[model samples]
Target: MKIQKSFAQSVGTLYLVPTPIGNLEDMTFRAVKTLQTVDLIASEDTRNTQKLLNHFEVKVPQKSLHEHNYNERIPELLDFLRDGKSIAQVSDAGMPSISDPGHELVVACIEADIPVVALPGATAGMTALIASGLLPQPFYFYGFLQRKKSSQKKELEDLRNQTATLIFYESPHRVKETLKNVAEVFGNREVVICRELTKLYEEYLRGTAEELIEYLSEHSLKGECCLLVSGATEIAEEEVFEGTLKEQVEALISEGQTSKEAIKSVAKRHNLKKQDVYKEYHEL
Candidate 1:
């Protein structure tokens, strides 16, 4: 195991600065200070970040490090850090690397034994979670669902038995469809939609998925959305197995699941390792 001491570092540090999701006042003093102090600011969008820097009167040199260019940009950024030129990475809104670009760079820095410091600030998931009025602790942060209907439904099915609250970020155009998928997989559980957080027109809609879908049928939603779904009811696992592991896997495969999917389902249902289930199924 490796230990990281953020402040005590010989090389230039990488500060993950969090920006405001909506209200400009949400920008912390430390965040502003770090941006000003850093030698270079690696931003998800240079143009978008420039506006924020302009607002805060922070005039640090900016470079684009978004999803499209991160693979190529990480090396140069690491070189800067090696040269003792500090960097503060910022996304367009909220925290960098939450649902944005920065995680890869963080991983790269860690692999290279570089210090990565994260400054606490605004995040849409937690910001919506605290006010969601649902079970707060042990909640799952699942940012963004699969856009394809079948794949998205499959993803929801994988989390069908989770007892922790599920949080997801969805675009305005797709929130309704995602809610429908949640209802189909997790049933008509309580769901909350937080919209335009920290802004003047912020709004929250709380109800079961079906109820929310009925409401959305009439109104057109605007702005980014955070979807919070209540967890499944706590239930004891089945005390007995229906058949041998091999038989169970075969049953699922016969019913149309791929071998990999069947093996995964068997493993999760029996609380066994996937490799163990695969071996039993293959008699290896």
Candidate 2:
């Protein structure tokens, strides 16, 4: 086990600073202070972070460390730390490494026995999850889903059995499609859509996936989105019949149940609409 005494020694410490997700006032005093005092600030977007720094009157010099450059930048930053010069890492918003850059640098620091300090501050996922009116604890925070339709559907299918509340970060453009996939794979579970968190236009849209899909169809959405989905409730064996939905339907049909009866039973057991079940059963 590696124990880190962040401030005990004078070796350069790597501070993982969390920035405000949307509202500027959400910035923590400690975060501001760290930014003000650190020798160098590694930012995901120097221009974006410069605006925040200017707002808080922090004039620390910054270097870009986004996804493309992190691999080459890690060594240079590690050298700075080795020289006993403290460094601070910040993303465009929220915690540096939560679905953002900085994880690699943090791992590099730990591997090199460098002290790493993390400041607690605003996080979009948790911020939305708590206000989402869903079970906060026992929640799974899956930062961002795959952008491709097939990949996203496969990911959702893998998460189908999780009993914990699910959290996902999604862009506004894909929220509707993602919700539709959730409805198809997870079966119309209750979902809360949190957008523009901590900002003046902050809004939460709560309903079943199907309802949200219809709502999105009528209204346009902007800004980032956090999706909070209720966990899977217990399913009885009798309700499911046997294997996969298709397999179960086939088994019931072989047991003398009509094709229509098998489809209806599978739909009800899985909390899906009859039409959806029919389409899946027939691969339509």
Candidate 3:
């Protein structure tokens, strides 16, 4: 076990700095000072970070460390640290390594016995959750979902029974489709859509999943979105089933129930339509 006394070591430290999500005022004093003092700043997007640096009057040199180049750049950054020159790692916005690059570099630093310092700052997931009016404690932050519909549905099926409030980051282009999938799998539960967080256009739209879907059908959304969904409430005694809908339907068929009878029974047991159960059983 290696212990890190942040300032005690002669080797350079890897500072994980969090950039503002949107509003420039969200940048913290310590974060700015860290950026100003660090020997080099590794940014996900140098062009975007340059704007932030210019605003803060931080003229520190920056190197690119994005998803595509993280593996190749890790060793180079570690070398700089070994040379007693501290480095700062920042993403396009918010904390690094949270659905962004920097996790791998952090791991490498720990293994190499280099100190890593993380400064508290903006994070879109938590920003949306606190204002979502949902249960703040016991939340599951799921950053982005599978872009494919089938994969996303399967993931939702696994999370359908989780009791924790669910938080998801989604792009504007796919938010509507994701809401429809959530409604289909998790039922029309209460949900909140937080968009353009910490910006002038920041807005929160609260409604049931179905209602949100209907609203999105009429209103086009822009910018990043955070979806906060209420957790699965206690399942009714009669509604609980032993296996998946398809499995239960097949089991009923084996117990001398006709296909139609099995489908209806499974549907009723899971609060689904008989046609849906039938279609799912046949893989249609």
How far out, in Å, is residue 74 in model 3? Answer: 0.6
Q: What stretches of model 3 exceed 4 Å from their correct place? A: 235-284
Encode model 1's per-residue lDDT on 1-91: one tens digit a residue. Answer: 7899988888999999999999999999999999999999999989999999999999899999999998899999999999988999999
Q: What tens digits encode model 2's per-residue C-alpha lDDT throughout 129-214?
A: 98999899899999899999999998998888888999999999999999999999899899999999999999999999999999
RMSD of candidate 1 to the true fold?
5.1
Worst 10 residues of 2 by lDDT: 234-243
Poorly placed runs, candidate 1 (over 4 Å): 234-284
Clashes of each: 0, 0, 0
Model 3, 1-116: lDDT tens digits are 67789889999999999999999999999999999999999999999999999999999999999889988899999999999999999999999999888899999999999999
Q: How close is candidate 3 to the true structure, as a TM-score?
A: 0.84
Please say which candidate is ahead in lDDT: 2 or 3.
Answer: 3
Give candidate 2 misplaced runs (Cα > 4 Å). 235-284
What TM-score do all the candidates reach, one by one? Answer: 0.84, 0.83, 0.84
